[model samples]
Target: MLLRMPTSLSEAQRYLAEGAVPVGGATLVWALWQRDGFPEQAMSLRELPEATLIEREALGAAVLLHQVDDRVPDVLRRAASTVGTGAVRRTATVGGNIVGSTLRCLLPAALVLDARATVLDREGPYETDLAEVVAKRHLLLGLRWRDPVTSGYYKAPGEAGGPPPLVVATAVHTGSDGRHRLFVAVRDGYDVISETVPCHTGPDRALEALDDTGLGSLPAEAREAVRREVTGILGGPADR
Candidate 1:
């Protein structure tokens, strides 16, 4: 398999149009390679101008997970820190994490922060919600968001060295009316649920949103256990 390394956005797009899979950091690409399921060619975004750009309120897709630090928000930094071992964190790119099949550790924070992605596709450049960018498998260029007032994250581990069973990320935003509101994204395994509600509303809203998918598949006791643990992390039951 050939790796196409492009030095410009236009060159990257041209390669993408010709069916070369876009690669950043190559963590996911390596995983696919190990399984022998990766495509015959991949276009590396490392040399492109967008790869390492980090502004006050934005991060380029190619920014490594280890690079998410105090310069970024606490919630984002915390989530990125927990993703993998030191070596994997150093090699995983934000864009690859977002678009990967299994929801990586970074997405819940991105979702709760209301992040928007800047993408370049065969159709050309455009901006859209990060969720859509992931859903559509767009070639992510970078992500942008207004500064959140405050944020938090929670994870329920499965077993030693295994994937977490649940993760919740929260952000506090002040409305135009000047009241703080809470937004949350809950990841139960690979599925996710998000909601916006009054501040301190707790985990019920997001958990209920996951009913038909994440929570529904679990046994009754297990669901209750999730509710209890998430509630402890998020605070008292929903005020509403």
Candidate 2:
């Protein structure tokens, strides 16, 4: 395969449109081989402009997000490690997979909160919903949002020797207006979205209930069961 390193994402996109696949810093040939065969182009994103927040904004009634940072979120890169063994982790990137919208990837983590992405659309620096941007395969510049309450992530193993990922659960919470903004994220096959609640509740009870529903295949019956089990053990504030 031929390697053509581009100085920017636009260059990479041009390469992709010209019948060459963009590749980042990872072991492209090996990662590609594990999936199919060889890649057409090995592209580099190091020189590409990084993402940063421009300003902080209120998400709902309760959350406040940091405006900007020149670096990628550490939690995102950490989450990518869940995809596979050391080989995959060595080369994977947070913005890379997130731009690609890999299920069980960083995008899900950000999506669970008040975060939103700002990208240059045909009009200009357009603010796109994370879910919508991923759906249309649009380019992502960066994301900004106030972090919610405590955040949790869970990963599962897949079949031996494959590129597929198995991540069961992810959640984020922040209290506002006397209510805990609860969000539960789960990956189903190829989709990752959150179930959020912005209402008053005991943090202890919420945390306890959340503990019981630990990752993977929790249907309605199971969700309720966990809720019940956790309530008993959880030391929570009495409802007003």
Candidate 3:
């Protein structure tokens, strides 16, 4: 297979424009090979500096998962650590983590962060939310977000070293007037089955808003378990 390393963003864009499949860490490449055959041409994004940087609120697409564990917010760091073992973490890129496996550890955290992505296509770089990027199957160049006041993540693994059956992420921001904006995303396996942004004054009220979204759709036991897990993370129910 032809492997080309592009040293600049524009160069990478040209290669992608020419039909070269962009490769970050090759984690996704290998996974795809197991299902289909190898791709004809792969352009490596490792040489592009923008692909590996973690600037204030922007995360380059190719930044390694371990780098995120070391540099991002606590909630994201915790989520990054759950991605894989030490060795796997070393090789997996944040972009790969997001695009390669929907059920992986980063998506829910990014969702809670209200993250947006910059992507490159035939026209050029464009900005869009992570959800839109995923839906359109675009090539992600970077991620950007503003840190929240408080955030938490919880995952219920299906097995010892496998993808979780359920993953939940919550972020809360408070305004000066004492109102709170709570964002929550619940992923059942590979899909984010539910998402809600409810304005509330306390944890109990926030959860009550979530309940109104039909959390009952999940199995009764699973729903209760997730509730308990999230409650523990946010601290025992308390008044704002």
Global CA lDDT of candidate 2, please?
0.48
The predicted structure with the larger TM-score, 2 or 3, is: 3
lDDT of 3 by residue, 1-240 (tens): 688788877788788877888777887678777689877888777777877777646788888888875356556776887876788888888887887666656887787777888888878788998877777777788888876667777777667656566777776656457666766767776667545544555557667767777565776765776577556645643311
Residue 110 error, candidate 2, Å: 1.8
As a whole number from 0 to 100, the lDDT of residue 225 in candidate 1 is 55
Tell me how far the alpha carbon of residue 64 in candidate 1 is from the true structure, in angstroms, after superposition.
Answer: 0.9
TM-score against native, each model: 0.79, 0.58, 0.85
Which clashing pairs does model 1 show?
none
Clashing pairs in 3: none
Overall lDDT per candidate, in order of appearance = 0.74, 0.48, 0.72
Which tens-of-lDDT digit does each residue in 1-240 have in candidate 2? Answer: 787655555665676566664443343336555689776665444455543223333111001122112132323333544544565555554445655535536665566545677654433346777777677755455676664434444545557655444343333444554455655555545666455543235545465545554433455543443344234322332211
Number of clashing residue pairs, candidate 2: 8
